[model samples]
Target: MIFAIVGPSGAGKDTLIRGALAARPDLRLVRRVITRPTESGGEDFDGVTPEEFARRQSLGHFALTWEAHGLSYGIPRDQITGPGDVIFNGSRAALPEAAQVFPGLRAILVTAPDILLAVRLAARGRETAQDIRSRLSRASFEMPAGIAFRTVINDASPEIGIARLLAALQPVRA
Candidate 1:
């Protein structure tokens, strides 16, 4: 089974994934390739130039790809293959397509209140005030129909959020 971690920015998706991985070493993480510089620093992902990204996509190197916030993100086709359960940070808007690509794809929607989201985004220091507002505006996206999903409300501390994620993923563990 593959788990697609989807959520708005600043919802602590990366943090929860890290904590879950620490506790559940058997779960595999798919390192995504993005068109943003590596030093941008939020999640651990490979940064590639747009040309390189397009080239790889043309070569059929990606299992899935989507564009968001003016950046391109891709999950390598090879990474989705293996013996264990896999997980990747994915876009909420791409859930429908993801479900088609990987049958039995379970989505974990990490979320927080708008107020908390604003605070968290501001704290990141990576986006301008206007950019933060832009992100917050599109935060509340409805999950597409016909997809199996679980929600993790990351409204508390990081430890608590991670615990919630672990609990949600418990039943799916192999």
Candidate 2:
């Protein structure tokens, strides 16, 4: 099963994913390829130039690709094959295409309140004030229909959020 972790910025998706990984070593985390600089840290991902990203995408290297926030994100075709339970940070808008590619895809929506989101985003220091506002504005993006999903409200401590996420993932464990 492929678990697509979807949420708004600053929802602590990376934190929860790291905790879950430590707890369950059997689960595989897909390292996504994004067109953002590696130094612009958030989650651990392979950052590449737009030209490089386009080159790879054109070579039939990506199983899934989507554009968001003026950047291109791709999930390499090799990463999802022969996996145990796979997980990757994914876009909400790309869920439909993801489902079409990986039929048994399960979406894990991590979320927090708007106030917490604003604070978290600011603390990260990855985006400008205008960019942060732009992200916050889309916090309420609705989930598309016809996808199996579980929601984990990351509104508390890291420990609590990880516990909730693990609980949500229990049923889907291989």
Candidate 3:
């Protein structure tokens, strides 16, 4: 099984994923290869330069790849294989393509209220105030019509978010 964990910037997707993984050790958390610096906090990922990322993609190293915020992100091909369930910090645009690759794929769309999302994005300190505003304006919570997904609102706390994610992933029994 493959589950795509997706949401707007600063929706606490990575934090929620980390907490859920701690409790459910059997689940596989797909490690992404991203162009962002490793020091930029959120999800733990394999950091690579844009050149390297393109090279890897050209070599067919990624099962899925998408570009956002002027950076390239890729999920390694091997990570999504095998019998056990795997979760990726996914992209909304790439979900359609991913669904084609993994038949039993489902999505977990993590979200927060606009105000909370703005605060969270600003708190990250990675993006400037203008950038944060631009993101908040562009990021929509509306999922594609007819796409099968579970929505998790990470508004209250990390614990609540983890519980929601765990419940959504109940199909992936460990």
- TM-scores for every candidate against the unseen true structure: 0.96, 0.96, 0.94
The digit string of per-residue lDDT tens for model 3 on 38-87 reads: 88877789998999999999999998898888999999999887766788
Q: Which consecutive 10 residues in model 2 have the weakest lDDT in total?
A: 165-174
Model 2: how far residue 28 lies from native, Å:
0.4
Query: What is the Å distance of residue 166 in model 3 from its true position?
Result: 0.7
Q: Write the residue-wise lDDT of candidate 2 on 1-174 in tens digits.
A: 789999999999999999999999989999999999998988899999999999999999999999999999999999988747898999999999999999888899999999999999999988899999999999999999887799999999999999999887877656
At residue 22, candidate 2 shows an lDDT of 96
lDDT at residue 157 of model 1 (Cα atoms):
87
- Model 2 bad stretches (over 4 Å): 172-174
lDDT for 140 in candidate 3 is: 93
**Pairing residues by index, what is the TM-score of model 3?**
0.94
Error of 1 at 4 (Å): 0.4
RMSD of 2: 1.7
Model 3 weakest 10-residue run by lDDT: 138-147
Task: Evaluate residue 65 in candidate 2 and report its C-alpha lDDT on the 0 to 100 scale.
Answer: 98
Candidate 3 deviant stretches above 4 angstroms: 172-174
Clashing residue pairs found in predicted model 1: none
